[model samples]
Target: MTEIETRVLRPDAAGIAEAARLLGAGALVSFPTETVYGLGGDARDSVAVARIFDAKGRPHFNPLIVHVPDLDAARRFADISGPVEALAKHFWPGPLTLVAPLAEGHGLSPLVTAGLDTVALRVPAHPAAQDVLRVFDGPVAAPSANPSGRISPTTAAHVLAGLAGKVDAVLDAGPCPVGLESTIVGGTPLALLRPGGLAQEDIERVVGPLKTAGDTITAPGQLASHYAPNAAIRLNANAAHPGEVLLGFGPMQSDLNLSVTGDLIEAAAHLFDHLHTLDAMDRPIAVAPIPNCGLGRAINDRLRRAAAPRT
Candidate 1:
């Protein structure tokens, strides 16, 4: 494919407006969310949506998450139920994505849901995301702004590095605060599809004991081998293998530390950025054991997937 020069736009009012205009015109724009940057296109425009898949070389079966400005806008696309409503009331404008039944005639591109009856939706808390979504005033189908099954981008430079020539523009709003994807919750019994920025305990607190989703590819980030880097990953390692980089937690003398103080929140915020750093080293990576609690569960989940053998 011929490379197209990608523009990195400022987060000012004019930049947001230009990004919105590009989305309306069926162009791909990468913008920051509280979690990760998303490569977005108008959800209603199949041509634009196809560009997202083509740009990332994403699989057709993996669904895209539609980001709306607020709950009212979200309601227009998905049939939000009481449980979904309760979760949305508390977690919307934060880091939780609710996958629900798609409303009839919702006008979303069929490609967004991969012909499934459901659609993934979220109201991102990022101010730039809010401004762009509000100005665009439509559903924007976006996946993480990187090549398929690779490390998610937490900064505008990461987006440009992976997709600079493929996307029309990237909204440069600096590094993402939450360095993980949103926790995806959905299904009739309200299962946790993907653990991410929001802790599983917090979601269970909102909606009782949540069931774990089965091994089905119903949502984004559900693939067996995903969120991987170029180098092979070894998990729960006490020390790096020969020539391997050690990504340590709670610091016991490693090349890099997620958090020396064992703060899971800080670790979650730095997870992807650190992975990006380690991947650039062009060496195998080893990670210390992360406790399976709170945000640590989400971190471990991502690490395990990253370590999974590639197909």
Candidate 2:
């Protein structure tokens, strides 16, 4: 990829127009999704999709989630099973990616699927994202808009700070409400490939029990040591260890609190933003224990990966 000036486009008509134009030309554009900002490329363009991997330094074998405008659009790429369709019907236009066998003549670059027989598809609900996808009128292969295995970007500044010059532009639309990635569910008899912004309980209510994925990297966010910061991480801490910056939950004195009221949703929203802040301080991070319930499960999932030994 050539070193280009990464523009920060506003989330307006002109901005959305530019984003679509760039994407159509097979250029990488970082745009807002409800979960986190995504580095988007034309899913059908092999060169563009390859640039995404180069920009993020992401592994070639780890597939990306193809974001589309609607279920009809998603169906054009991947087969939708009864359970997958149920989840999509319940969670589409929101933070959920359904992985299924690739449809015949899907027309996607093989890079999007990492040479697998399946593909991951998502329909985001963010208005700005909808505008871009609708205007672009095509599937976008997007992964979280930060360097691979690093903290996901919740704001445009984070994107610029991490991916500036590597990508073409960022459609800045402020912070993401859901600060985690979408839950990836797929395989025969639907399995939860990754825990993310959407809660497991909610998905179960919609599609019954979901089988858990094994060690294999079947989808995005399944990487063993992803969503991490450069600094060392310590999870489930009651208090900050000496020389460690504490990321607090439920308001005890600390460097920063995910939510003083102990609300998991609030904590989930603030997770990456807070981690970005502390990681900038050049110190280790100690995170307070978040309950294994609802969004906390996603929060803890990310924290555990952050604390995992770096390969």
Candidate 3:
């Protein structure tokens, strides 16, 4: 594919209009969501959707999450009922993606679902994302803006650095607040397809226990060795070994700290940013142990996957 110059669109009326126009014309745009930056394309356009996979080097088997303006918009494509309905009522317009059966005559490109019977839909809470979706006025199939199986981008700079010429443009609205990806839940009796910005315990209180997703790649973000850095990673470390940089969780001195107070919310927001910072330093990563409770589960999940053996 020939490289095209990527435009950095400001967060303004002009930017939103341009973004919507570009998507309507079947072009890929990278914009910020609360969880992370999302590489977006008009979901109904097969060519645009396929370009997303090509740009990110994403496997066709792994699905993409369709971002909509609101829950009502999402209902146009997916049968959000039962557990999906219950979860959507509580978590709509937040960091949650619900997998549900496709609604009849849903116009999404088959590539968005990777040929699955269900589709992953999210009503992102980011104001910029909301504005783009509202003005664009259609479902957008988006995944993390960074290259596939690499660190997810949390800022406009990260997006530019990783995907500069591949996309049509980036809607720059500054850094993402909820730095982790949205928590994904679906399936019979409700299941946690992927742990994320929302805590598991918080969801359990509303929907009782959730079944854990198995090794089967039923959802996006389920790849075994993903969100990886170029350097090797060692988890559960108290300090860095020689030639390694330490990523600290709680109050401790190191190359960088996720949270000085050990707050999971703060840590979750810092996870990707810190990894990006440290990864650029050209050394291995030694991560300080993160508690496996609450949002830490999502942090650890990313770390484990980042540290996983590459294929």
RMSD of each: 0.7, 0.8, 0.7
Model 3's lDDT to the true fold? 0.94
Candidate 2 TM-score to native: 0.99
Q: Candidate 1: where are CA atoms >4 Å away?
A: none
Q: How close is every model to the real structure, measured as TM-score?
A: 0.99, 0.99, 0.99
On residues 1-311, what C-alpha lDDT tens digit does candidate 3 reach at each position? 76989999998999999999999999999999999999999999999999999999999999999999988998999998886888899988999999999999999999999999999999999999999999999999999999999999999999999999899999999999999999999888689999998889988998899998988877899999999999999999987899999999777989999999999999999999999999999999999999999998999999999999986
lDDT for 40 in candidate 1 is 94
Model 2 CA deviation exceeding 4 Å by range: none
**lDDT tens digits, residues 1-311, model 2?**
56899999999999999999999999999999999999999999999999999999999999999999999998899888688888999889899989989999999999999999999999999999999999999999999999999999999999999999999999999999988899888988788898888999999998789998888887988878999999999988999888999999996998999999999999999999999999999999999999999988889889999899986
**True-vs-predicted CA distance for residue 216, candidate 1, Å:** 1.3
Each candidate: how many clashes? 0, 0, 0
| lDDT for each residue of candidate 1 in 144-173, tens digit (9 for 90 to 100) | 999998999999989988998899999999
For candidate 1, the TM-score is: 0.99
| Model 2 Cα RMSD, 1 decimal | 0.8
RMSD of 1: 0.7
Candidate 3: deviation at residue 28, Å?
0.6
